[model samples]
Target: MLSYSRVILSLFAAVLLAASCSDPTGAIIPDDHSLGWGLALADAVRDSEFPAGVLFMVSCIDVNDEGDPETAIPWQFYYAEVSDSTNVLIVMVQYIGTTNHIWEDSTSIPLGALPDYADAGPWVTAARDSLGSAYSDWEEYALVVKGNEYPEFPVVLNVAVLQFMSPDTTEQLSVILDSDNDNVLGIIQY
Candidate 1:
């Protein structure tokens, strides 16, 4: 049977997968909303990650902005064509919309101290789903950190990270990396 934490992660992931997309040009981290019209794209890339012609789209969703220390959530999306010739995966980080994360947290919880669960859900889905596939194939995977707890709160901002892949011999990537809250990095392919 699945543990409560696992179930929460699963449900959160599923819910996020369904409604995960932001403007990618909103507020900055909580308490730092003054950062201005865009969020920084945190990314890492390597050669042979995927084939050429791979397209990537990214978006971020705001979780809360009710009051002070507004927390902006990250919801990224990637779309691309899958092909045998594709052999390079480039991780491009893009800014998305702004969100208010305060709606989910209480007065005692610090915005920055918020658990990884808040930032992890959308990030994992975005990073893993960058290929526009609902899931990943054997050749690659996007390492994502699964959460154990699904906090009960409201979302103020919702972002979508869209990506495009180059299609060749492989089928169209149509899924994101689904995990079981193991905290293991999800793999990705080109």
Candidate 2:
């Protein structure tokens, strides 16, 4: 009983509904490489209108990609006001459905000392390559960028590749790198 135009409109509406139901937020494809890291950091700093001088540490955790060391992941930038070191500001950037979502919060406990603000792409690549075939066994990756708190090393890049053996047991490989020259300081397995 419906006209041709009405039938066509109804079918179109049905198709749209199906698509919306399938992917409500569209695809969540991450960026090509760790390029998102710099982009997100810049976006967060610009949008938040916060002074970059206070930034102390940058980190990303819970990364799951096994093959690509440069895979994009959410990054967190930590800043501490010079006068008020007791409270630290956290700027978190997450990519969702082709756009980035940036949010900020404050914490009482900071991660570490100041950051060297070095590019993490090269460090990640070197770390993964050093792992060789063992890289496949790690299900998660995490990296922290901060000044060396120890007197022994001037490390600024701390990358951890981990594989969970059981609920309480895990195997971890730690890659330490210097920010001054991007040199691999050490690789320890535990």
Candidate 3:
């Protein structure tokens, strides 16, 4: 079980991510969606904030798919999109300053913030809901592979963990792509 304080943070993150993933039309969560960084955090444990770090948003579109600019996840990473365009907003937040847990693969900064990352683009949220609510409620983040940089490096058939990291914990939303075909996965935090 999680402590009272931990639960509150987790819930807040869940709601934030949920809102981020969705748009004016709605967000989609697949059963086999790739379990990204944030998704796992909400899935396995409860943290007031995630371990500060950087998460990569990767995506590709299916030409004949449904919805405006509908697409499928590539075999590499996933991203949160407010619209069809590549424009996405990765909300950078840090609730605490120090943490014992650090991403093993990445070097940790000595100071500044708990979770930190950057985007190659600017962020723009709904200023005001001219069409009802100025909020997009996305339930899950989408994992899509754009490309495999090393094509000639002996491509081995393996399961690639294309996902977004919370810089804290790997928790919910969903996992659409999987090792096996014909299925997608989704998760929720309460």
Taking all chains together, each candidate's TM-score versus the true structure is: 0.19, 0.57, 0.17
Model 2 residue runs over 4 Å out of place are 1-49, 64-73, 97-119, 132-139, 154-169
Candidate 2 residues 36-133, lDDT tens each?
45445544564466453366566677443432223445566666665566555566565432333343455444344454444566666666666688
Sort every candidate by TM-score, greatest first. Answer: 2, 1, 3
Cα shift from native, residue 54, model 2 (Å): 2.7
Candidate 3 residue lDDT tens string, 1-190: 4698899999999988888876544544432222233234321221332332223332322111111112333222222221222322233111111112222232221111111112101111111111123123332223332222223322322111122224343543322222222122222232
- Among these predictions, the greatest lDDT belongs to 2
Q: Which ten contiguous residues of candidate 3 have the minimum total lDDT? A: 119-128
Evaluation by lDDT, superior candidate among 1 and 2: 2
TM-score of 1: 0.19
What C-alpha lDDT, on a 0 to 100 scale, does residue 45 get in candidate 2? 66
> Top TM-score: which candidate number?
2
Deviation from native of the Cα of residue 135 in model 2, angstroms:
4.0
The digit string of per-residue lDDT tens for model 1 on 1-190 reads 5698899999999866655442244323333322122213222121133233222333333322221112433333232233322222224332223322111111111111112122334444444445345334322222222121223212212222222233343632322322223122323234
